[model samples]
Target chain A: MNNNPYYGPEGHGPYEMIDIGDLLLEDGGTIPNCKLAVATHGALNAAKDNAILVPTWYSGTSKIMEQVYIGAGRALDPAKYFIIVVNQIGSGLSTSPHNTGGAMTGPNFPKVRIGDDVRAQHRLLTENFGLKSLALVVGGSMGAQQTYEWAVRYPDFVKRAAPIAGTAKNTEHDFLFAETLNEAITTDPGFREGRYGSPADVAAGLKRQAKLWTVMGWSTDFFRANRHKALGFESVQAFIDTFMTGYFAPMDPNNLLSMAWKWQRGDVSRNAGGDLAAALGRIKAKTFVMPISHDMFFPPADCEAEQRLIPGSEFRPLASIDGHLGLFGTDPQMLAQLDANLSELLATRVN
Target chain B: MNNNPYYGPEGHGPYEMIDIGDLLLEDGGTIPNCKLAVATHGALNAAKDNAILVPTWYSGTSKIMEQVYIGAGRALDPAKYFIIVVNQIGSGLSTSPHNTGGAMTGPNFPKVRIGDDVRAQHRLLTENFGLKSLALVVGGSMGAQQTYEWAVRYPDFVKRAAPIAGTAKNTEHDFLFAETLNEAITTDPGFREGRYGSPADVAAGLKRQAKLWTVMGWSTDFFRANRHKALGFESVQAFIDTFMTGYFAPMDPNNLLSMAWKWQRGDVSRNAGGDLAAALGRIKAKTFVMPISHDMFFPPADCEAEQRLIPGSEFRPLASIDGHLGLFGTDPQMLAQLDANLSELLATRVN
Candidate 1:
């Protein structure tokens, strides 16, 4: 794909960058020479209404998303809809601690909020595409946070919203888990104020982080049932290497920490005078809150609560032992269900 | 408290030790002149059948258990029965990596099993106290593993058994969680292959481990309800520092790793020719299996499954949102229920 080791080749389409310059952050710090890495598929029609926006999740790149979810027969079919996968700020492919220029790179990068991402994406749509509104805004995990933010922050822009395996307001357990991830990185002896060279410097912490993911990202059934074997892994270590450790090893620790902090502090409530109910009330988009049944990070009950607050919002709990990783459609049956749900949402008319 | 950093001084009556020289570990390694640290309260009656055994849990010593659960009006009332709290092999208070001699000290300590603990404890009961049997064998977490092992390995030796907030055999999730804990230490750059000069060398890893515990050891409600404030901490950081990081800071990383390995590999089924049902069927005690409702590590369902297999076992799931830490009776009401349950189990008649 790109020179960045954090990204894999073949999953994402052609990469493009847009510079906004010297973007301000939530914590008063700034990321200079602001750039966003984006990928696109299918041509935008003259009507422009067929454009669908997809945001990437934690440690996820646009290409991986394309590889997993985009296809002719998939819910996110590139043939039917103009698909745009935007990499988040801290993701190494975009303006990140690893790629960004200036003193604010690495640990010095300010804490960016979910709100910032929504705002930046809005600019990209308005200025680059000159699109008035999106047919759909869909995402999973932290990407779900952005989807919810889009619906609430610019409700008129997102006609339909699908947030999977994540919540509008992160649960305390999620916050604590994110904190652990960040701590695992920052506390590594080789972290050295986030100025360390090479991923090997923090290999131990990255391994530890991957191990934690083995427990949280998937349910007990994922291991006991040897689901990794189904994914073509010879053993659990192979699975970890293929997905967990290998995925994170090349990542910049500072960027990971930055993203984790944003994930933990994600609160749409802050926009509605610290009222979560009011925040959900502002969302005009046709919302479908989809949560994986066994997702430890974002339980169905948490997602259900948000869906209940939004008028006409649907609550879909995906019963998958794959847990949070179900966001990737680990089961083809799950992908079918997602296709059906998306088709239903896209076909429905709402004023 | 025998001046051990792993223990508190006020609650435990007195500390003692027993030499079981040249102890053979489950992994076929030996610790020369092995000594087991123990604490005792009340009196061993003339019949020597009035003794209650309590094995220490992970990162816990006898005095700490005394500080938390033992008292005049407590379920673990010293005056009612002779209670012997035996620290596990790798517990710093016992013959651990921190105190063992020669090659067995530090990272060189051999892997020990729940079976090995039961064997050593049996020797202590027979050779020192002249006790033919224990009136009750009760424990929590890793301690619970030993409790279950006691009921199965020497079923006739334990008249009554209560294993709380833990499972007889580690589940896939539990194994992953244990592996994560060990990896947190082993991957620490300061660990220097587990031959670090001081605790500071492993402070970063231990902090990361503590952070993980904060997420998994407690439930979502525990943090959302701000129960840490009930325990006198003002903030989550304060709570994590006081109850988590501080609690683990003094521990030897090698000992923690050894115990974690033992915990992950604990499967009584091996004794029954790899049949879990057969192993549980061997439990002849009047067993009361208590699992915390919200324990992510050891779900109540897993504990229920084990209870169903053991004949004459009473399945009692503790209704608490405190997760695994409820074993220390985090809430007063939870403790009251535990007291009532223990009293009921102790008073019941069995074959």
Candidate 2:
């Protein structure tokens, strides 16, 4: 295993670029050359037998997942296990619509699904690292959707899986939030059919999208406790200004819109014959379904419901007031519980 | 007392209009020529000692209060008590900047407070109705603010007071919500500095203001459970369109902006030396403070805190999930509770 740093300041990451030379499509059309990024870490010497797969969330890159990698005592600890993290398509750090050799730029990007993301990751693992997944696949939120897809798409590859803070099916309320954000972006006058436009104008739409997030991302109790102090202004205007100023301070407006669109179209069961129950049942991996208790978007109820549908799946719930952001907040008690359970699972090697 | 229906469609009920010719102000100015609509039900002669003063909430009129008066077994049941409902100034049905013989319009209107509202009600009771004392002053929400102000300003004129779902002083959160709504109105280009360039344009601003209310007026759970059916639209866009259509259909934009401005400036103790606790302590009326448990704007904690400061005051929290709307939703149960307590107090009237 190499300890070389993956991500450099500007662009270079865990996944090295690979050129897919021009090929003939199924429709008898010539397809342009494309390059994909593939990143691998941990014990590749043991081949696929010691590998664990990690998929990226919306706008996240494989390098971002490096934060979760550990040398020992952690879920993705490299001391005893190999961890493979992949950047999903459409993410700027990977093979995205923005940099697809003029084929999928702007509004021309093809709609991709969780299955497509898992399929691409599987190819990278098998073709580049010579890994046939043997250990576990773990992810949270949208990443969890990819994890679930991996279990179903390659049942023989994944021995165990942990999908946290995600649902097999998106609820109506989830659709509303996602759709609203999508509209806020696309409806901007400068969107120009998703083509060239002022990045600053696009930033305004992103700010509006972020405002909805600031409201829904936290629990009501959290907002009630810290709104005035957090924003440093008494009125809602202050809250809006503070939120917009902080969220867009470090991110590109185009990148924000791209990620928001991906989130809006995210639906695991959309391609699973619209039968989430059947899809979960097909997962041969021993699954640990853990959900954050107070997650406004994907609550414990969703995971509990999924657990009941998947045979032999263990259900664990992490209690935190941080809502969907609990995975990022890393509550001590929640992390300890997760660490203990994951360590025991890996130690026992029950497959 | 005479029974005459004041405003609204003719012959609906009894309403009496009181004209206050002129009141000299301490600041060497004349108070706006004021007219009030008073609605009375039941025999004031038989239950003259049992008469209760009920003030309307912001934007509410005598017509709306009539529902509370006639509600079965309510605190102001016309069958047993003489209920005198007074419309607060600035409401369209009463003396307002909109219809004060064109005296004060748009930006020319004076900033009025709860004390001013209570004072006007006091004049109507004393000079027009020939009443020296009220058995009780009952109100909810903004109406409750006026009721509390009456107790502080005219302690000797009121015996007992019930202020529901209201705070003795506005909290920062309350100001934030009100300020946001006001900004949503005034910032709209159509507002044109309180005077719209076009009536239709002003109406659009009102519709936008109302949209914010529709969202904040209810709890998140309520919207999630009812948005589909209540909005009568399948898609999110359709739902928002339906909502905006209904909201803007009947409201005058100017009226909405003016009312929101009034609400923004609604500080009951603004004149009380800026000391909220001291202002509350000045109230001499025996007070029954009932804040709705789930009222987001005026939570039970606010009323409970105020109750601790007021002498001879009792806190009775209305346990309901309707939030600020609990003033109307807390029907039979709230009515029964108030009746049981007020009946006991009325039976032992001091006069």
Q: Give chain B TM-scores in order.
A: 0.95, 0.83
lDDT tens digits, residues A110-202, model 2?
Answer: 555565566666666777677766688888777888777787777788888888887666565565555544544554556666664444556
The residue-by-residue lDDT of candidate 1 on A1-351, one tens digit each, is: 113454533444468888866677766867666788889888788888888999989888897788777889877788889999999988877777776656666777777889888888888888888999999999999899999999999989889999998889888778888877776776677888787886689887787788778788988667767788888888787787777887788877877887888899888998898899999999998988889888889878778878999988999777788889887668877777777888888886865
Q: Write the per-residue lDDT of candidate 1 for residues B37-79, one digit (tens) a residue.
A: 8888889888787799999888777876777777887877888
TM-score of 1: 0.91
**Runs of candidate 2 exceeding 4 Å displacement:** A1-104, A107-131, A134-166, A178-196, A202-211, A227-244, A249-258, A261-350, B1-31, B34-70, B84-216, B223-245, B261-351
Instruction: State the DockQ of every prediction.
Output: 0.56, 0.14
Compute the lDDT of residue A207 as modeled in candidate 1: 75
Q: How many backbone clashes does candidate 1 have?
A: 2
